[model samples]
Target chain A: MSPSPPQLSPKELSAYFAFTEVSSLLRHSVEKQLKDAGQLSYVQFQLLARLGDAPGGSQRMTDLADGVVYSRSGLTYQVQLLEQRGLVTRAPSPEDERSTIATITDDGRGVLATVFPGHIATVKDLLFDSLTADDIEGLERVLTQVSAHLRANPPRSAGSRKKS
Target chain B: MSPSPPQLSPKELSAYFAFTEVSSLLRHSVEKQLKDAGQLSYVQFQLLARLGDAPGGSQRMTDLADGVVYSRSGLTYQVQLLEQRGLVTRAPSPEDERSTIATITDDGRGVLATVFPGHIATVKDLLFDSLTADDIEGLERVLTQVSAHLRANPPRSAGSRKKS
Candidate 1:
């Protein structure tokens, strides 16, 4: 194999390492809070929270999968788990007979209602508590730019999904 | 419930969402690169890279787990996989008979050498490409603070592991 290319600058390396460690730790903290509050995983809470925020408390499965950055098969499995627990329901879409739609149930909303406070608190403690208002604005601007670029040029693995 | 504890301010909410999306996308991008370049998962790459970076090219298992934000059992599994591939070896620590030390083999460094360029490129493309130097500084500062806090008060699930 060809020799490794030039190394990243110290600044770049430091920034990337810190960004990664923070992300992992934050996810761990949030996952624990969700589990303790409602026995929910992070992605499960994301799906429920997204549906709770939707226009009709529901979204097409494909849409939910894309919004949450999950594989369609993975989303289907989580939805099935939620459905079994009575927190969500899946049905044939009215607009497209071949498509399935996922809707949050009253139980789902109730779970969100129960878990959200702890979620918010966990986020604040692990993330926002250390950041100043200016830091928040700066992070928002930087991450928003990066996120749009990533969404436009998604990884090949995620590009096969039907776009919503 | 306490009415969802009032919504986060738009600025805070936007920042948090952007942060979450950016973190997820970056991981996906990096995972794809590692898989293609070295047939490595992100966590496996992390362990290898960490071992390569450590002084004397070795570290205790518990220290590795804590540094990587992984569960002790999970780290044991990954270390075993690497050992099976002859990339890393685990031996009784001379300093502490009860502890096992993981050391990178020459083959492990070879794999990291092969994949580091692609890893750096992927990180730059998905993250640093859009970020200004000022953004890098801000991110490093904010994330370092957050990581330090989270490491100090790690999630309950991960707290059971012996700290190194």
Candidate 2:
């Protein structure tokens, strides 16, 4: 006989999956929004915008990965692609030879300048415009709680637990 | 020039970019959890499992797509891949001739049965285990509120603002 499916109480279900749904929708909305101005993905736009603001338009790869929610390797791969496109360029970090630094090319900054206004507007509508003032404050507080807790208790065996 | 990148209020910055960090880590954790055994992506597992629970192991493609959070095109592509694997099949919908129905095969059920238990456990740990009871409740309420708000205030423009 097959094992019984573990049932989550409504509260538990709401607590766990509900927020993921919102976050996922937000990403989808963002992705769709980005597709309008140009071919750039949301992360690509973010990387360009960040680099445009950083000192000398450059930052270490590790910091960029953290800011963009990309895995280090995944970010490296994407950055290399952007570099090849002449959207950005990479150089050996002056601070650490072990690290690579990425900078937005003039072309990249120009693309971002073209794309960012509309992108930010979409973010406001899809996210901020939907929430009441109280809702925003409440959500910020809860998310902060979640962020702190997740940092303190990173998933351990959780990753491998779902494999057959 | 061009507003000097404007000083973003702290609240806006945190709300816009910060949660992406948590969502990224959570996705990494889920992906890592599901890589071995069958290498089933979360959407694939979700599609198979949802179909397994349907009458005749089938559901309309649009309904299934909404349930699993994929856009219609994305779900269609994924279902085609599953069909290639002989895990699912599609047919004309009887009640709605314009719609397509998706049906999971025995192999799909077998795969879901093998993977779902650990998936739920991992979800429970990756999420619930990291949150306090109050935090959980707070988050659920916040998400429910946000979800409803978004549905009510659908974006009229795809991407045109530059606030975030």
Candidate 3:
């Protein structure tokens, strides 16, 4: 076992607890909405939404995995599920025969359109409703800083390898 | 189809994106650490930690579910797993014979002690290292408000009934 680390400052512990608890609650709320409205899991919704927003309505599978922070094999299974549902289509990339590109199909767009209203409502009701504009700004600034730092120096345990 | 909702203000979108992304990355990082070092899933670790922190180091099973925002059946399963591992013990609540209480065992405390250093380091390295004192204070204040509001008006889709 590693030696005991120094105690976290009260501020650090309090801030972390609040951040984690809020994140968990928010995810639960969003996941329930997605499931109820679209029969979609949260990660599935994220993949569809990202593909819907991408240029030319498609992205390389590797890029999509990175964007969602999902492992390559895990993402492949998700994409396969979506393809079977006709919500997305995967094809070989034009520029690289070895790489695959995933595009949201018309069915995918329709599901997004159907689910968007409820999704937005849930987000607004559970998250934005309680946040003041100033609080939003502060959250954005702090989280952006923390995110960039973590992205650049990801934990070794995350196993986030970039596969081309 | 429902009518399109109004667009979120750019600030709202930006803030929510950062918040969600940060939350996701932090969870992945923490989960990896817990899995690697303690052979525990994130939710399992949460259950143990919360039980460890409760008064008398025990809490009603229903209360644990609410505190962790997990489904009743799901918490029951997790507690059963912990019990099999000798990390937690569940007994009928003395004050409420109809309810069960979960308590962390000495072995649970030992696992916590072993993994806590890595957990604290991961948190500090990924989250708090970049945050200023003011950022920490602001985050705690804003998230506390949001968490309370969401807890009071949780999403209908969560299906969080208090089962005795």
TM-score, cand. 1: 0.92
Which candidate would rank higher by DockQ, 2 or 3? Answer: 3
Top-TM-score structure, candidate number: 3
Q: Whole-model Cα lDDT per candidate?
A: 0.86, 0.74, 0.86
After the best TM-score superposition of candidate 3, give how far the Cα of residue B102 lies from its true spot, in angstroms: 1.7
Model 2 misplaced regions, further than 4 Å? A1-7, A66-73, A84-87, A95-98, A105-110, A152-164, B1-9, B52-56, B69-73, B84-86, B96-98, B105-107, B152-164
Per-residue lDDT for B60-164 in model 1, tens only?
A: 998998788777899999999999999999999987899999999999999998898988888887888877888888877877777787777767655764665
Candidates by DockQ, descending order? 3, 1, 2
TM-score of chain A of each: 0.91, 0.75, 0.92
The model with the greater DockQ, 1 or 2, is 1
> What's the lDDT for candidate 2?
0.74
Query: Could you tell me how far off, in angstroms, the CA of residue B22 lies in candidate 1 after the best superposition?
Result: 0.9
DockQ of 1: 0.62
Candidate 2 chain B has its poorest 10 consecutive residues by lDDT at B1-10
What are the clashing pairs of model 3?
A: none
lDDT of 2 by residue, A13-36 (tens): 876666677777777777776677
Candidate 1 clashing pairs, residues 3+ apart or interchain: none
